[model samples]
Target: MKPGTLRVWSQVHTWSSLASTAFLLILCLTGLPLIFHDEIDALGKAHKIEQWDEAQLVPLDHAVDVALAKRPGEVPIYLSFDEDRPVVNITSGRSADVPEAEMGFQPIDRRGAVAAGGGQTGGVTDFLLDLHKDLLLGQGGMYFIGLVGLLFVAATVSGIVLYAPFARKAGFAKVRRAKAPRIGWLDWHNLVGGVTLAWALVVGLTGTINTLADPITAWWRADALAHLTSGEGGAVQPYRSGLVQKAVANAMAKAPGMRPQFVAFPGSPFSSGDHYAVFLQGATPLTKKLLTPVMVDARTGEVDAIAPMPWYMKGLLLAQPLHFGDYGGLAMKLVWTLLDLAMIWLLGTGLYLWLGRIRKRAR
Candidate 1:
């Protein structure tokens, strides 16, 4: 690129990075612990399951009933399984459209005993999640952060563009530490940014997609969900524990290899008014994030059809794990943490360089 062109790109890199740096730093800091959320959660609430005979395991329907009984006037929205223990986590809400903040989580052991129960009011991790997701601005905050993500992408690209010229002249890792402080930090920033380029781009792009979750889900509910339940319109039936179990069974029968992740109740945003949406996922590491919704007749408990999620919805689901860097094993999480630290350093140096330039101009 010509020096003029390079200077223009530099300007873009400067402002773009500067504009999004603060928010991106916050996201990186918050996201650090989130990468190890499972580990942290286990550390916070350590519980051991008593060894029980197979016969002691309670029916899923009975567990759901138990969870519902604990929260009178509430409905079962989702039932999640624990991987390490024979524990079933039930999420109950006031209605099908209850906000996530208002939902309750109740954990039941294999013997149908309440294991852990609590309100869904998130604590520190939840606060970090909300801050990283949308600055606690709800959906609007998500969009704002998404905009910042786009800016980060642009900044990354511009940095790459500028790096080409610099790398051609000097070793990619050369930091010029013997020079002025500003020069040394600039070199360090360039080196770190280049090293973490791919990770930064992946996290940035995936994060941008994750921000579209609400819109994508809303569209699916209006389009795919509407088409699925078009001819079966009637008064929405209340979810019955027995029918829910039957629905779960029917869903597994249809999708032989998949397991139930959650069941969206009739009239819920994720399900049609006339059907139960049993969301199933594969058993493998990669396919686990890909959810397939099996629509079951809420009134009759008969399997209707497996709703094919659109590419956009699939991308959103896939982006979440990728953005969080939770898909890979412990090694991957360690690498992600290191990359996060590098990005933080990159941001700090970029800020320092920008301020130094301003100081020079003032002089």
Candidate 2:
């Protein structure tokens, strides 16, 4: 690149970082708690069933029935499996994901359901996730952060362009403690940012991709959902959940002892007809994250097809675990968390440097 081009890139890097620093700071702050969300949630009080074995597992529908028996008007909103417990959560509510803002999530177990431990899912962890994903603003907040992520990428590329010239003046680690305040801050910003480049860019890009989840999923449903139709329509109208229930049962019968990772309901652009879209996880490490979904016909409750994920959708699915870093152990989590904090530090110093330069010019 020419000297002029490098200078222009540097200007962009400086201004872009300055423009989004505050929001980015909030993201980093909230992101910290989420890094340890699993660990933190584990610290809480738990209900241990001494005899969950019952010699065998009970039908999930039975558990759902138990939950509904407790909350009459409520419908099953979420049925989450415990990562390390025999507890099954049956959250009942309206079609809208979260129940009313006032009456939050209600967890259910095998024997019965109860309104227990409803003080912000993971306390600080939930706070951070909400703030980071949507800034507690719901969908709008998520998009805004996604846009910030886009700008972050642009700024990262521009920063690298600027780095080439900056390196001409000094070595990679040449931080001068006695330099002018602007120079000192800039050095620190670059120091932290440079080392964290790979992680930051990956996090920013993947996070941005996650932001487009609603749309991407819609697109997938539009295209792939039809794939389930077998060149026919009218099988789904109003999307009865029972159709999905029937379909899931059919798929499970065919899967032969395979466990369900998650299920997509019908009429949801995410699902077709009433047939349930069931994803089965591989029992092996190499294929655990890889899933093959079985499509069941909504009306007939019969198996439609058991197929591999579309290449694009499969890539997206795999990217999720990689981005979150939850696939690995504590050491991996710590590394990701530390890098996240490094991003926070880099953002802080970069903002300080940008402001310092502005004040200098003003003086």
Candidate 3:
């Protein structure tokens, strides 16, 4: 790049990183625990059920019945499975649209027995997740964080551009300790930031994409999902809990290789009022996040339609786990944690350099 172009890129890099560094720092700190959220949650959870010689898993409806029997007046909202064990996790609430804070979680063994200590939420882990996701500001906060993510991406690109010019005289990753404090800090910032460049970009872009989830889901409901259910009846009457198993079966049958991940009951956000949306996922790592919704008539337990997930929804699904760094197991999570710490160091050095320059200007 020309000297003038390099200077412009340098300016862009400085301003962009400075503008987003604080928010980015918050994300990094909060996200550190979130990368190992599973491991942390496990620490607080009860021990897994002892594996029997041959444990025959109960039907989905049986698990739902057992879970609801424990919490009277509650309705089943979602059913999730344990990846490693023959266990099912069921979430229930008073109503279909009840908030997550009011929901109850039940982890049941293969025999439909509720585990000793597994029906709760709102812990330190959840708090950290909420903070990292939205700064505890809900939707508006989420969008703002997303904007920071975009700035971070721009900063990353500009930094790469300027690296070519700035490092012309020095080797990449060189620390000029002989220089003044500001210059040394600047070099440290560049080196650490560059080292974590790929991960930072991936997390930033994916997080930005995730923040659009609300709008993207709204659009899907307004367009594709609505179109799929246009000819269906208006509001569906309340259906019995017995239909949960049938709905799961119908969904799994529709997608031969996929397994039911969760069931969105009638009047739920993900399902039409007239149907139970049984969300299925493939067993493979890549397809696990890509959910396919199979709508079943709530009253009749008949398969209504199997709609292919739209691109935007799929993008969100893929981005979430990727951003969380949970897809690659313990090794990947450790890698993510190390990179997160590096990002913190990079932000700190950048701030130090900026403050030093401001002090020099004032003097």
User: Who wins the lDDT comparison?
Assistant: 1
- Which residue pairs in candidate 2 collide? 243-274, 244-274, 275-298
Query: Tens digits of per-residue lDDT for model 3 on 1-363?
Result: 777887788788889988998899899899988888778888956665466533366776777788889999987777777655667788788886787778888888765465734545788888998998899999999999999999999999898777775577667889888987667777877788778878889899999999988888878877777777775656644648678878788778888999877777776667777888888888888788888888888888888788779988899898998798887889999888888898888888777877887898999
Q: What's each prediction's TM-score?
A: 0.92, 0.83, 0.89
Q: After superposition, how far is residue 243 of candidate 2 from its true place, in Å?
A: 8.3
List model 1 lDDT by residue over 199-296, tens digit each.
89989999998898888899988887777767566566786768877888899999988988888888777888778899899988767888889999
State the TM-score for model 2: 0.83
Which residue runs of candidate 2 sit more than 4 Å off their true CA positions?
46-55, 73-80, 91-122, 177-181, 231-249, 252-258
True-structure RMSD, every candidate: 2.3, 3.7, 2.7
TM-score winner between candidates 2 and 3: 3
lDDT for every model? 0.84, 0.68, 0.81
For candidate 1, the 10 contiguous residues with the lowest summed lDDT are: 112-121
Model 2 is weakest, by summed lDDT over 10 consecutive residues, at 95-104
**Ordering by lDDT:** 1, 3, 2
Compute the lDDT of residue 265 as modeled in candidate 3: 72
